[model samples]
Target: MSKVDVQLADVSISPVQYQAQLLAALQMRDLDKFTQLLDHCRVDAFSSVLESACREADCAQFVQQLLQHGADPNILNPVLLQTPLHITAELGCYETLQVLLCDDKINVDALDWLGNTALHYAAQNKDQDTVLALLEHGSYIGSRNHAGDMPVSDIEPETLEKFLNTRLKMPNDESLLFKYDFLVPPVALDSALLKNKLSDEKDNVIKKLSSPSPEMDPIVQISLSSKQQHLLLHPIISSFVHLKWQHVQKFYYYNLAFYVFFVLLVTFIILHHHITAIDEHRKSCWLNLSAVCFFKIIMITLLAICCFCLIFKLLFQVCISPVQYLHKWSTYPQLVLTLLTINVLFIDSGTGDSAVTVITLFLAWTRLLLLTGEHPAISICFHMFQKISCTFLKHLAWYSLLIIAFSLSFYALFHDSKAYIAEKNVSSKLFHNPLISFFTTVSMFVGGFETKFLPFETASGTSHIIFIMFMFFLTLVLLNMFTGLAVSHVQNVQSKSELVRLTAEVNAVFDIEKLVLGNPVCIHMWMRRLNLSHNAVIVGIFKSFVYLWLSFSWLQCFRNIHHSVLLFPDSSFDYANIVYPFGNSVNVTWNYRLDHKVLLQAANIVQKKNDEARQQLDCWAVFESYEERLNNIEASQLRCEALQQEILQLLRLR
Candidate 1:
């Protein structure tokens, strides 16, 4: 009989006597006999000797002895198509896995029949050491199995967050919040691997299993998830982003400089025009009228160019993260600013025109902050402000009904407070109209009790009671609620400041990538000869600028530049051609031991993340089985009821 037929503890009487002895030694967990048997035994594809050794926690020493003699650590069982490490991982044999990992020749990331790495099994296991060992050994965290499930996708973030790092000063990497594709350019979309479609029957099965809610659809989830940004705390990813940041800095800075110049010129023109229109003496004065017109023309031209650039950049940004770009509150304001600027040429000099110019100017200043978001500090502050604003607005939506009720009450009750208005001489139209009264109510909440109601005449005691209740509600309840909400957001921001800063760094880098490179073309960007690619790079840069003016959007004429430069060593491009600013020559990841150590640590972190997703899927399978069994029992019950009804009908006929 073949060695595969041998039972775990039941060793049969066979001619290959060494196989029986080896099985006996492994079952007993004997180190001495196992070592002696290894000298006579050899590594074979069909042999389950090494696979059985990894099943026992105490057999690590024997497993190491087998590897030292002649047995392969990476021997795959023909049936399961999994290596010994896969067995160790699935069984949570921490000691056995530790022994296997020590072998320099071991394939730590060996794939099984399902295209799953040993780390994928490790993630599903509760053994922390096994997962950590695989990660530190450099099992790629971003690797997706044949089912399109990433290792990290199995582990829920809430569970992973519990044990990740509670006490130590080790920072939490929030960048893992997003999928790998967020930073990855569209180059992978062109890859043939993603183009394959599942069979129609398989699609139908997925649809039946999936929730009927459209929001839960995979495409909808992907779009929604795109809005969630990340804090790129990983050193390898951050190193790449820092390089990209340098490439795009010049274009961003140039835009800022031109904007600053234009804003100053607009301020000068607005002030000069105001002074001239009002002052009789200056209206007829020809002192620098020609110069004023010259600057006005320059301002308009500069503003027009700025508008075009922003629109073009926005278009490219949407292509990278479509949902994210559209949902941003800043997007609407930017669009409005561009439209107002276009109308400026035809607008007449009057109050209507002044209002439009002022709105446009206000929007222009806000964008200044958006432009400066490339800096880490600025990006953190901006994100903090944005998050807090969202939180505050959520509360405001709930409180708006109360504010509206009070405003309408005041407008109705105080409509003809004739004696009070005449006595106070409050000429500001404070509460006479709907718009004015609504704002007055809001201001009262913000600035404390408005003393203007001291002498207000009321039709009855009911009006006085309403006024008192409104003051109490605004002052005591909603004000404190809003204050507490803001405070909580501020405290949270302070706690995750480092992670948020890293997130901003990632966004800044991506913005630059979209602005400069646009997208990858069919041809490889790596230049063997400097002259060939250099000309292509120059032409790409020139075309990017023209795409803005030609169509007020990013419409590339030539081929796209290489995105591989932004991705660096992780990308498909050869690593030897790259040179980075590694200050003081500490250690190189690929060329030295430092990167090897880092890869292992990164792998360990990712292994823990993938732990729960597979477990959840297993539970879903169990639920489906129970439902099927219920359906079978229900069909049997209906048949029995029909037979009883037929028997009753026969008795009635007799």
Candidate 2:
């Protein structure tokens, strides 16, 4: 009827013209010319061919042939500019897509003329199998068409099941829909696009899946458990109290300032009122005593607060890092309560009759010791011995000054006189008068003894008048010197006492386990090692003895206690034996010299041992196995022995 359509050389006849010709070939399953004509025909000319294929219901094979021949499934018609794949999918021809996607050349990701991919059209057709076919080929699942419908989301459960059945026939693709089982809703799809760049990787899929479920992490689980434990151990109100201690230092200073002002003002008022009714001498002493006591309390309270704050902060910082169940005992609430109770129980009354007051004072001193982080025994002894040479020189200077002064005063008393009797009388006054002797002795003890060398008296006049004036002037100077020394001594004592207290506290907090994790802090562990806790007092008595020795020698000039015993930067000369001159001199007459030699020999042995130990440590760092370790040790020991033998041979030759 079509003028007897000619048969080609391949023995396949052109069955029908135009759309019908293409459809007949597709129905007959003649893939050869079907592929060729698909290549020759323009997309515009192929529109009716697709429609005819759909009508024949042999569209699946036709679609596959078109794609194999390089037909763009995404290409629009010349008139409508729409793709055949979208049109077929919209018509619910699910088989067509399965065949189309199998070709692997068609862009499953491509949109149609209506801006709808095959997936979009499939949702409109309510055909889940077609949707999945496009999805498996890396389709933009959940993407909107021109009509704004998300076909992926619109896919019904039954339709999805059907699609999944067909999907089993296809190779697994790393698409968002393949990775996540749930259909990505339209709202979520947009949000996910903004936040995360979806990668086609398994690890990325796992990470994304876990992002919304943090409880799956073991560390997070541990943290949650620890939080519950913390809650069980610490009451809510107590935790609030603990947090307050975080800023205790600020509050401590504020309270200290206010307390000092209040206490001093009250003490001053009381003293002023009492002084008017009491004798001058008694009034002055009482006023001084009251002021000292009041000030001491304020200082101690502030020091206690500081120590508590530091300890609590340290405990919390470490505990929080490991997500530990923070104990109530370690918390600020308990620490503050304990500290307050100690203060109340030990603090003495204003009249100094209360045991509570004494205890509180002692605790305050302890707090100050911790705050200073200095060791009383070690620092005190060190400073005392450290100053021996300087102290001795100072004393020597005073002694020379005193001798010159005594000689000059004698000369002035008798130089122009007819008799030595008048001179003897003046000189006797220098030694006999309590005021003169006191001033002169004090000056001689200090380097200030030089002023006594001045000649204030003469043989011509009565020496008593000149002697009195000299003594008066000397008294003023000596009094000022005593006041300065006393004040400095008090400050030094306070500092040392505080150090001792801190050392004790340090000892309390020193745990071998904690030390292994980190060094002991806040507490002076080094100082504590050198201290002795006995009865109610932990005395660095050795430090005191050393101080007494240095005070009497030429070494009192150097005053820093803590760093005193440390080796001097240069260390060219030995200063340890130089401090206690009198003691060393006396000891040298006995077996002390032998003891000193033995000590030196022991120190040398220790140094040699330390060097060996360091060598071993270095070797261990490099060598891994036990056999290697043993070899290294043997080699090092042999070398050391050979070196020692060589040194011995040299010494013998010398």
In order, candidate lDDTs are 0.56, 0.42
Q: What lDDT is obtained when candidate 1 is compared to the true structure?
A: 0.56
Model 2, 1-654: lDDT tens digits are: 121132232334332344465666777878776766665554444545654464445557666565554455555556544566666677776677566566655555455434466677776666666766666565654445444444545555455444333321112121101121112111111222112222344243323222111101111111134222121111111111222222122334453454344334333433433444445644365357677546655654654565455455456445322223244233344344345433442442133344444444444444433323323234444343334445455655765564455445644564443322343354324433434554554564454755444344443354555555445544555446545655666566456553333232222222211222122111111112222234223333533432342344342233232121121212112221111112222232112222233223333434554577789987886665777888999999999999999999999999
> Which numbered prediction scores highest in TM-score against the true structure?
1
Clashing pairs in 1: 135-600, 135-603, 135-604, 136-600, 154-612, 154-613, 155-610, 155-611, 155-612
Clashes of 2: 26
What's the lDDT for residue 385 in model 2? 36
lDDT of 1 by residue, 513-628 (tens): 44444422211111111212347666556434333333432433322233322433133223312322223342433333223333344445555444555677778889889999
